[model samples]
Every structure is written in C-alpha cells, then in structure tokens.
Target: MASSLATLIVSSSFFVSFILVLQLSSFPSCRADVGTAASYSAPYLPSACYGREATEFPSSNLFAAAGDGIWDNGAACGRQYLVRCISAAQPRTCIPDQSIQIKIVDYAPTATTLVLSDKAFGSLANTSAALINIEFQQV
Candidate 1:
C-alpha cells in the first residue's frame, strides 16, 4: 500500500506539471524591447495623431503617449503594446508578473519612452516612480 501511494503521488505531480506547461504554451510569446516609462494624467487631447477632435481614451484606462522613437510619423497611433515593469530606481517599485496591454492614443515630445496613463502605470508598478525600466512587446 505504501508503494502504491507513492506511485499515485508521483503520477499526480507529473500530470499537474504537464498541464501547467501546456497552459503556458497557449499564451502568445513575443520579443520584448527594453525601455523607460512614466505616468501622465488626463488632458490627453490634441494628440499628435488624432488632433483636437478625437479623444478616444480606452474605457479600460489602459493607454499611453508614445515618444519620438515610437511616433513613427504618426503611424503608431493605434498600436497596442504589452508593457511590464522590469526595474525601477527604488526597490519594490515594480509588481512582479504584472503586465498591461495599452493603446498608443497620443504622443509626447518628452524624453520618457512612454507616458502611460495613471491607471495603467499604477496597475503595473508603484506610481510614485517618475520613471521605471520596462519590457514592451507590440501586441
């Protein structure tokens, strides 16, 4: 009976590990780029891409303002990126395993690579940080 129980436990463990691998494989994986980001508040109107008439903030409040590197001459207006906080000046500023899908609704002439909305920034990391290292992949 002891040997039988051991066999059952090992089999269950293997089965659970296999299932986790399968589930993880189903998620799309893409190459990520290292960059820096900061948070910005509302008044995102008169954006470089949309002009004064358009103010379509995603209801999710997950949006960002692109920098010159990603402006792409206004071509990156509606691009969606999956952003994750990788590091920060202060420890514990980043939330582990947290990422958010955000739309580029505007552009910023500022130096920050991305100016994420308040909600978006807070969701991934501590908002008190003026800047944080990020890993981003276009999704």
Candidate 2:
C-alpha cells in the first residue's frame, strides 16, 4: 500500500508538470497571433511616416549658392540630407509631396533648378531630376 501511494503521487506530479509546460509553451503563440492580427488590421499605420499629408512649409530667406557649404549647388553638401518644402503654393513641386523628410547624396543641375542626388531624391520624390522647389534642413 505504501509503494502504491508513492507511485500515485509521483504520477500525479508528473502529469501536472507536463500540463504546466504545455500551457506555458502555448502562451507565446497566442500572443503572436494577437499581434499579427492587430498588424493586419492596420497595415498602413506602420508606413504612415512615408505618407504625411500636404502642409504648407514656411519659406526661409536664406538661400545658399551652389558649391557653398549650405547649398553647395550639389557639390559640397553632405551625401545625406532632409528637405522640406517651405513654399505653400508649389506643393506638388516636391513629389511624394506629403511632408516627407528625404536624404540627398548626388547632384543634378538643370537650367533653373538644382537636383539632389539619386538617393536623396528617392526619399522625397519618386522621379529623378524633376524640378521641385524644396527647402532643406540639415540632419
């Protein structure tokens, strides 16, 4: 009788331990499923940064010449930058016009306007060398 009682207790303890382990293991999957469902419901929320609405950017009087430290006309400027459109009337001039921060690396100079490097242009506008009026704030 004593041996049987000990065996029963051991068996019950083992079953309880196994059940606890299984419950704990399932917790992570349940949490993950909830997170995935939430993400699927609002897919655009994560990309909201890339789709800011159009807003008027205030113009600054300071205009740097090409090759100057500030403007550099695409020569001396840093390989990366953030450009914000200050002009309200010329909103579409900056494609992806929604208030976006862009990085600039290369230079393309045209008749009336100077263009940012390809990488920089990609941040703000999808088109390359397209004329767009923008004011840049160095990051």
Candidate 3:
C-alpha cells in the first residue's frame, strides 16, 4: 500500500508539471510591437503682439486699448480657445481677425509671442497667426 501511494503521488506530480510546461510553451515567446510616435509642428507665431514688447494683461482691469489677438480659426492648436475667456465681462474682439484675449497666467522668456489658454484665445479674432488685436470693456 505504501509503495502504491508513492507511485500515485509521483505520477500526479509529473502530470501537473507536464501540464504547466505545455501551457507555458504554447504561448509565443516573441513579443508584439506596440510602439507609437506623434509629430507636432512649430508653435504658432503670435504675430500681432510679437514685435511689441512683452506686456502684462490682467483680468481685474478692463483694458482694451492694449493690442490683443485671438487664435486663428481652424488653427491646429489654437482651437483650444474656442469660446472661453479669462473673465466673464470681456467679449470676443474681431479686429485683426486672428486675435484673442490671453490672460498672463504664466510667463515665457524665449517666446516671441504670447501664449493663451484655448478659451482666452477664442475670445479674440480667429486666426492661427502669432498675433491679433484685442478689445475689451469693463462690466
């Protein structure tokens, strides 16, 4: 009986090991390629405000005389500023077509043009050029 039990145990162990090996071998050893790459164009030029020195535009003050522009319509990246503004009182300006009102949320040292959030960019004229004229009124 003891010998018989040992034989059964060994057979079961071998069967289990064989099944595991078969399962592992059935899977392909080679890995599938799942890599991807994305391409981006140069940043849009804020042409309207480019030559002008860097100026600060704050939300608290209703300043329109200052030159502000919006992202151009159908701009690849400027679409972000479709219909949002830094402030509610400020309306979208249409002069110089590609202009938007961009609040100076962050600063850019090497940037020749100003950067605006999608919403703020949408508040000015629509264009993809670097710059556009902006107008504003206090509510």
TM-score leader: 1
Worst 10 residues of 3 by lDDT: 33-42
Candidate 3, residues 34-77: lDDT per residue as tens digits? 11111112232342333233334243321121112222222322
TM-score of each: 0.75, 0.29, 0.24
Q: What does candidate 3 score in Cα RMSD to the true structure?
A: 19.2
Residues 8-65 of candidate 2: C-alpha lDDT, one tens digit per residue? 9999999999999999897853221000000011121112112322121112211121
Q: Which stretches of candidate 3 lie over 4 Å from their true place?
A: 33-139
Please rank every candidate by TM-score, starting with the best. Answer: 1, 2, 3
On lDDT, the leading prediction is: 1
- Between prediction 1 and prediction 2, the one with superior lDDT is 1
Supply candidate 1's per-residue lDDT for 82.
Answer: 95
Tens-place lDDT per residue, model 1, 1-139, is: 9999999999999999999999888874657898999998877787776777554768898999998878887888899999999999999999999999999988888777899999999999988899999999998
lDDT of each: 0.89, 0.36, 0.34
Per lDDT, what order, best first? 1, 2, 3
Deviation from native of the Cα of residue 1 in model 3, angstroms? 0.2
